[model samples]
Target: MMNDESLICEETANFTLGNTFYRSQSKITRDLGVLAAKIYKSEQGRLRVLDAMTGCGVRSIRYYLESDADFIWSNDSNPENKAVIEYNLGFILQKNKGKITYKNANNIFFECFNNKDYYDFVDVDAFGSPNPYLSTVLWATKINGLIYVTCTDGRTGTGHLPENCLQNYGSYGRSHPAAQEQVLRLIIGSSLQEAATMGLGIEPIFAYFSGSTYRVMLRLLPKINLSLDNYGFLGYCHHCGEYTTISYKQLGKVNCYHQQENKYYNYTISGAMWLGNLHNKEYLKTMKNLAISLKWSTVSDLLSIMIHESNFPPYFYTLGEIGRRGKLDIPKRSQLIEALENDGFQATNTHINSQAIKTNASLKQCIEISEKLINNSKVGKIND
Candidate 1:
């Protein structure tokens, strides 16, 4: 029989996982979190972390060792994993550098709020919906602190369960080409709504989708920033493969602008979600610099894409969609981006999908651009 404990090494930390759920693929997420924590520590001159779902305590260990966190509160609701967590985090426990607790995440937040004890970094790597912690987490987060939230329930966020979407995020989710991005916005917008209720605000440092998981890192602000310009609906036209934003006042006029008076078109609207930039450009640049200094090439590359697409429209069009609508073979993502930029349009590859491009150019413009690129082989394929 295989032993319960297995040695695992990630980045600068070495730990043992014992029957606790550990996803090797999620290492990139952990890397980003650690980098953010390290940056916070450097700026604030101290790092205090509250990891709500410690699992095997890998996050807590990384915060302490890699981020140079001065103190950590690692809590998990399941007591079965206590021994494994303690074993992996024995040094910190013995040194009184942190504490290990078995408590519900909400209870911990409540306790912190009651005691006015807030953390500089609060990470709730929840398995499913983050609704339960969306509001409560703010209670334990210091003003200007960072809150990293996770949502693993893709179905609900992607409109598979529209009913559940309304209940969970206070927004309507509709399945579309940009559903992954939709979910990320939902998480941010929902958190903003919760924060705004308490006269607070938040700015997204980054929103990442790892194929199946959605994670957003937000910086809690001390003032209110809920506005129509930054929170609204996303409208997608099924017929034209186009996207547009709709404000509350535009609800009654929600129709595909591409539709002719006599033509019928299908439109899918998803929101009351975040309509602002998916990432902070300067912050991402800072993270990219740190990643480069640390010799983390993959992270640097990902951040490059994110920085480019940070201020793009809320949705993206896949190469396949462009090709199918234009009745042409799929064009290379890189070439399409080049074509758009040559035409004075903002275009870049989205980190959400490898074959997708997020740009301010309309879908028709993209199709025409793609067609021109395919025909003008001398100009188009060269960029390839």
Candidate 2:
């Protein structure tokens, strides 16, 4: 295969682009960067962005070609790939001279923040957990600046290894479909908690999970009343298969099955996290509009799902899982959503899982609807 292609980076048959072009899910990152730049330019004009871990500069190249960013700094530890980065950005570097710079990622944040240098955006897309870079970015990010971080360590994020999850994220993580959103919360909570220690506050504007990895983009702002209110624990009831998100203040009053006593009632608590909205509806609206203009392949579809679920709370319940627990036939996701809506419960589709649905309906109401839907399905199927 050829060494260079158009804007797209194609892998060679020999798999030579090992450490460099690894993030195959580049489109999501690119689309987000483009949308961010588009929105930033409209709101505050051009922006300066930093790709803290630029692997072969694929993301940086996209930023230059697809975004309205004024300057892009692609930094990485491997200086040997300087030529590769230069070649990738050749198209934009020619006309927009001095617009893109490549350098080592070594002590980059310290140098910038020490000199009071800040960027409109800073991305920490490291291979493993992005926790290590949080301290630095919190200081380097300008007020209202955006910071995008990705954690591919699904083992820890998903609670497969509780010890590592606790070590890196400082929270107990529970493994479940409904609690999958907690993995994203665990990551966001860590970033927010880390920022809080430094007298700064982090506001998560966008977050999504794909292929066992979680990508989140947040805004850095000053700490005024930014307490642990944004950070709290989540309670998952094993008996009813329902989870509740509660703040730290409510910890004293938290009980797994106090509302209803059942033989199978059991509860597990999961963290001091941001139980609030994982996404921002207003910003998501802006992203949808901006994404429409950009014409990405699957972004509009993804954004539509996120927009619908943006207004709802964090946890989601799966109809199939709930059906199995109720010992009833599974109801269609669409049917469940419609049933909830008809019952005056605001139901929405969750992008986290296709079989899952998010709604403002209480667990009891949701359980009631599931039984009703299954009963209706059984009658229809029996008649058929």
Candidate 3:
């Protein structure tokens, strides 16, 4: 039992069992909130935060304690958790008093979006798709504010259902080896479209796959960019494994292939998705520095890797996918990286998948390199 929330909780892995809190996510959520709060404080000073869909008020308290916030609004719809939240807040106030408010709202967005109100940070950690809250969250966020959103519907994100993914995210889906990265693009793209409607723009502050969901923190801006002056699309060529990303203006000329021009065919499109850089280089560098300065144990390592690989191209190549396409055995990750680097192409391991490499090398170059190691006698050195 924690005094602050008077939260008495039984921990269980099975969520189907009634009222069992998922205690395992506590540390991850704590670190993430701390990181978000500190980043907001550095850029915008004191924060006014909303811990939407808060369960038992743990996250709101964590943000209040760890972040440099002036206020925190923790809201949950479930009436059963009201006592638990009150107990925690009552005890918390006894120790460190702050302007922390609690509310029981059946639909959280209506409360946040009701007026000309704004918050420096709006965190929507919803149970499922997060699609329902995207528009409202985008509207409630202040210019120069931050929005940290999560989507637990990995099935739709990873392209398990084409129609459902399209319906929710406005992008037709297909399974790519880089499905997780694709999901990041899906969520960001969806938010961008919603923001653009109000002449707002969002730039990625941080994005990553954590546990069973995808979480992204974005910096909201009041002005919109011309490329995103409208919606967008991703023209993917299955034959050559290449993609051409175009905005609404360029969509008319989009073709899978043009034989005379010698472009690859078999293109199936996915978009109204944000075809933007996944990681912002300078921003990522700053976060990495902050992580180290704060002595964050595990996330710092991941953040460091993300910063180092930040300069690589938007998409990635999987070793197994490349090998299968070439009818050859997959080379060790280090060996593949070595081969690409030897050919003057940059290569690095991706956090998305160990066997996946984020590289500036084209898909053809990657396939060619893999074939060299396999079809040639050079395969002997792979074991060494």
lDDT of 2 by residue, 71-90 (tens): 77777777666666666666
Report backbone clashes per prediction: 0, 3, 4
Q: What is the lDDT of residue 207 in candidate 3?
A: 74
Once fitted onto the true fold, the runs of candidate 3 whose alpha carbons sit more than 4 angstroms away are 1-20, 23-26, 91-108, 113-115, 226-231, 247-264, 373-384
Runs of candidate 2 exceeding 4 Å displacement: 1-19, 91-106, 258-266, 381-384
Ordered from best to worst TM-score, the candidate numbers read: 1, 2, 3
Q: For model 1, what is the error of residue 180's alpha carbon versus the real structure, in angstroms, after optimal superposition?
A: 0.4
Whole-model lDDT, model 2:
0.74
Per-model lDDT:
0.92, 0.74, 0.70
Q: All candidates' TM-scores?
A: 0.96, 0.90, 0.84
- Tens digit of per-residue lDDT, candidate 1, span 1-384: 223356788876677877898988998899899989999999999989999999988999999998999999999999989888888888898989999999999999999999999999999999999899999999999999999999999999898999999999999999999899999999999999999999999999999999788889999999999899999999888778888999988886767654456665656889899999999998889889999999999999999999999999999999999999999988789999999999999999999999999999999999999999888875656779
What are the RMSD figures for all models against the true structure?
Answer: 2.6, 3.4, 4.4
> Which residue window of length 10 is worst by lDDT in model 1?
1-10
Instruction: List where candidate 1 sits over 4 angstroms from the true fold.
Output: 1-5, 259-266, 378-384
